[model samples]
Target: MIVGIIGGGQLAQMLAMAGQPLGIRCLFLDPAPDACARTAGELLCGDYGDARLLDELARRATVVTYEFENVPEASLRRLASRVRVHPHPGALALARDRWHEKRLFADLGLSTPPFVAVDTRADLDRALAVTGWPAVLKTRTMGYDGKGQRVLRTPGDVDAAFAALSGTPLILEGFVAFDREVSLVAVRSADGDARFYPLTENVHRNGVLVQSRARPGDPMASRAEGYVGRLLAHLDYVGVLAVEFFQKGDMLLANEMAPRVHNSGHWTLEGAETSQFENHMRAVLGLPLGATHGLAPSGMVNFVGYLPEASAVLAVPGTHLHVYGKAARPGRKLGHATVRAPREGDVLDALARLRMLADAGGAG
Candidate 1:
């Protein structure tokens, strides 16, 4: 079967690479001339709203999916009329707006941070009055990797926070003094059979994810599963979705959701019995979902900024490096590396060793 993937980034590239072995042809759509997926598939360079490109893609692919949540709703709606789009556009719409996301979670009785909508200055003021200071002001739409968000540490910071977003739809969220942030990567089949990977403990630097350790042993894993179950049932969602959470005391607070494969789950490529990309494809294709078993205690570290020296990283025992062949730029996610070891060995220790190798300019 042919699978057409929207957004030609490393995720699409990895999806294409994984699909190839399964006798599935992959195609990618993106405007970036040098997008990483271009090297792995037949890339149609065009805007997501370009009807001409969508028409061509529909004619070629048996099914369509997206690599990122930021895909234009119009594009998905247009394509859905011609071909199948997995996980449904409703999920996409929900994921795009933070206020809607929080509401959905609440409606389903899922735990989420205290949040209020902010569309106007008055809304911000009201939200602050209720949620209080030291909150996070985030754009309701088009936010990722810490972009389009500002922290309101004091009352004085509120105006500047609002000014920074320039009156875009917003969500005023109370800060969770959480112990750690975690993500649940789960897949729901067309038949509604859901399988979940071990939860990942994430560490972010400046809002961008830096590393993820698998099976962090948070009691929240079961709670995360419950949240995913309700979310999938609500959307009748088919294919993979990742939900992020903040652990505050014994409670797990919903942070956000990703409708596509997530960066935090990259360790599954080498660490799990079923890689997320493959499971996502299977779920979307109406095939049985694969096991989410972890092969080992693993940690995935993102390679950001300049490309790291690959040789040094490869030299580390149990290290697996994946580099998205992209031009080097400061703060850009060039690729990632996963280090696997026995469950008895310290996962954090492996992560620290990988970090040392990465800091020394080891190849990624």
Candidate 2:
């Protein structure tokens, strides 16, 4: 079967790589002519809203899926009339808006940080009064990797935050003094079978994911798995969905949900018995979900800003590198490296070594 993936970025590139060996052909559509996935599959370069191009894509592929949630809803609706789109557009709608997402989570009996809509200055002030100060103001749509978000520590910061957003509909979320941040990458088949990978402890640098390590001993691990199962059933969701959480004391507060494969699950490519991309493909294709087994205690470190020194990092034992093959730019995620060891502690040590090498300007 041929699958046309929207948004030719690293996620689509990796999905193409995974589908190739499984006898599935992958095609990509993106505005950028030089997108990384363009090198791996048939590339259709054009605006997402170009109906002519979308129709051509639908005719050529057996099914359609997206690598990112920012895909135009109208485009998806138009394509759905022709070809199958997995995880469904309804799921995308919920994932695309923070307010709707919080409501969905709350409806599922899941706990989320207090949040209120900010459509006007009055709404912002009201949200602040209700949720309190030290809140986060985020755009209602197309916000990711720490962009389109600002922290309001005091009342003085509110105007600047709103000014930065420039009147876009927003969500003011109360800040939870969290103990740690973690995410669960789960997949559900079309028939409703669900599976979850090990929870990952994530650390962010300037809003972008910098490192993720498997947290096998987390007390909330079971709760996270249960939450994912409930969410998948609630959305009737099929394909990989990642749920991020803020751990405060004994509570795990829902932070956000991604309808597609996530960066936090990058370790699964080498650390798990089944990679998330493969599982996502299987789920969408009505194939049985693969095992979510951890091969070894693993750590995934993102290579952002510039391409990391791959040759130097490869010289280190048990290090596996995957480069996205994108052009260099400040704060751009160019690639990632996964280090594995017999024990989880050893994986952490390897991450420390990798960080030192990075500090010394050593190449992969």
Candidate 3:
């Protein structure tokens, strides 16, 4: 079986690696001639909007899937007309726009931070009225890794933010002063079979994920699962879905969702009975779903902007490193390492060491 992947980045590369043992070959269509996923599969280099390239991918793949949420909706529709795109095009479209995504979450009975759409300066004022002070202003589309957003606390801040981010549809969400951030990574099949990894507690810097710890028996796990499961069944979703949330006391407020393999679930590669990449392949292929339980106390640290010496990282007991084959640049996701240990304390100690190395490497 051959799977066609859109956007040949690290996620696609990992997916290809996971599928290899299943005798599933992956072919990637990526605009970047140097896309790292090329090392894992055949790469057809071209813009995602190129019709000829889309046709070729459709002609070759058993089924198609994406690695990111920002894949152009028109391109997705074009592919759907010619081939199967799992997790569905509608899911992609909804996940692309913050307003529509929040609406769907609210409609599905998921609590969300108060939000209002911002299109004009007057609309910004109106939205701020609803959301109050210290809210976040984000472009409704194309925002990721903490880009395309501003924290508005005062009139001057709001004015400067609007001046900088205007001309794009925006969303104003009430700032969440929550205890912590966590995400649920779940996968569902076309047959309705589903498996979920333990909830992940995350730490972020500059809107980029820095670390994640798998919480197998988190007190909030069941609530988080209920919310994400509603999304899976509602979208009739197939493949992996990650929903990030802000936790306050016992409440979990929806932040956003990613429709494909996500940064938070990277720990599953070394920590779970079956890696998220493998299970995503199985779900998209309509094969049996794999177990999502942790192999032990697990955690992960991301290598952003730079990566430390591999020997230093591996020296941390229970640490496994994965480096993306790409040049390091400020704010770029270069790689990650997963840590698994017999006890939570060991996992935490290893992660603390790994993060220090990651921070030092990225510092330069």
| Candidate 1 TM-score over all chains jointly | 0.97
Two-way lDDT contest, 2 vs 3, winner:
3
- Poorest stretch of ten by lDDT in candidate 3: 355-364
Query: Model 1 Cα RMSD, Å?
Result: 1.8
Give each model a TM-score.
0.97, 0.97, 0.99
Q: How much is the lDDT of residue 115 in candidate 3?
A: 97
Query: What lDDT is obtained when candidate 1 is compared to the true structure?
Result: 0.88
List per-prediction Cα lDDT, in the order shown.
0.88, 0.89, 0.94
Q: What lDDT tens digits, residue by residue, belong to model 2 across residues 1-364?
A: 8888999999999998889899988878899999999877888999999898899889998888999998898999999999989889999999999999998999998899999999888889999998887899999899999999999998899899898995678999999888899999999998898999999999887888988987665678999998888999999998999999999998999999999999999999998989999999888888889999788898888887766577878876788999898987778888888988897677887787766665453332
Off by over 4 Å in 2: 358-364
Off by over 4 Å in 3: 362-364
Return the top candidate by TM-score.
3
Question: Alpha-carbon error at 300 in model 1, in Å?
Answer: 0.4
Model 3, 1-364: lDDT tens per residue? Answer: 9999999999999999999999999999898999999999999999999999999999999999999888887889899999999989999899999999999999999999999999999999999999998899999999998999999988889889999899989999999999999999999999998778999999999899999999999999999999999999999999999999999988899999999999999999999999999999999999999999999999999999988999999999999999999998988999999999999999999999998999896452
Highest lDDT model number: 3
lDDT for residue 293 in candidate 2, whole number 0-100: 76
TM-score, candidate number 2: 0.97
Which scores better on TM-score, 2 or 3? 3
